[model samples]
Target: MDTQLIRRRMARYVEMVDAGDIDGILGLYADDAVIEDPVGTPALVGLQAIARFYREGLGRTEASAQLTGPVRVAGNGCAAMPMRVDLMWNGEPCSLHVIDVMEFDDKGRIRSMKAYWGELNVERRPE
Candidate 1:
């Protein structure tokens, strides 16, 4: 797999998220893709589940993510993209430092995406 291509794809993914294009975002995933946001939540598998997850997750507020650093890729089709998330979670504005580890399939679509974040990564956004 071309690492540069994957990096570019991830960059586009972030852009899609920031743009609130749910369908466009889901297009990057393989049919059987799995997402484990924050790594502990039950994984959302398949397009339907993934779509539902993002619809509620992204629809909740004015959410946007900006890349904080380089996209790191491994030889085995895995990449780590660090980003800063600004959103209004449950009517409360907040910021979070996040890293999404995406594992791509041979077709170059994301097969798995696991987000790493924690309570300490959460911060209040000024009113």
Candidate 2:
């Protein structure tokens, strides 16, 4: 796994999220990719499921992700990205600090993504 490639891809993923490009974000995943956002919910599997997840999530509000730290890449085809997600929900602004672990396939598509975040990490944004 090329470290630079992984870093570049992950960085692009962040950009897509920030831009609210659901299709662009979904394009980053493999056909059989799985995402366990927050690590406790039922995993979203495959492109269709992943698309639904992003749609419902983004539909809730205007959302964006800003990197809070450097993207960490390993020798393996995996990387960890730290960021803060800002969004409006129920007419209230909210923010969540998150770290997502992404595993890539040999083809450079994300095979798995697991987000690490909890209620404690969430905050109400000031109006």
Candidate 3:
């Protein structure tokens, strides 16, 4: 995929998340996509697993994400975006700083997504 296209897609991902558009978010992935959020957990394979993961997480929470930096494109068909996500988790307001690296398939769909964040990157928001 072209770097510009990937950048646009990454931006769209943030827009969809902010809009709480799950279907639109999923539309950016390939049928057999794989995701490992925060990168060490078990991978969520295929669209169904991915859907369930998002539905149970972001879907169940009041969540919004913003890109903190420009999308960085790699020589390979991959791009990464820096983001800050604020959401209601377990009835508490919190935020996470994340960097998501996505590999795109030939069709320009995300074939793999690996999020880089850890507990240190998470912060509790004061009410």
What TM-score would every model get versus the actual structure?
0.95, 0.96, 0.96
Model 3 residue 58 distance off true place after TM-score fit, in angstroms: 0.6
> Can you write out model 2's per-residue Cα lDDT over 1-127, one digit (the tens) per residue?
8899999899998889999999899889999999999899999899999999999987557888888999999988989999898987557899989999999999899999999999898899998
lDDT per residue (tens digit) for residues 1-127 in model 1: 8898799889999998889889999999999999999899999999999999999888666789889999999988999999988998657789989999999998889999999999988898998
Across residues 83-108, which tens digit of lDDT does each residue of candidate 3 receive?
99999756789999999999998878
Which numbered prediction scores highest in TM-score against the true structure?
3
Model 1: what TM-score? 0.95
- lDDT (Cα) of model 2: 0.91
Per-candidate local distance difference test: 0.91, 0.91, 0.92
Stretches > 4 Å off in candidate 2 = none
Question: Positional deviation of 116 in candidate 2, in angstroms?
Answer: 0.5
> What local lDDT does model 2 show for residue 26?
89
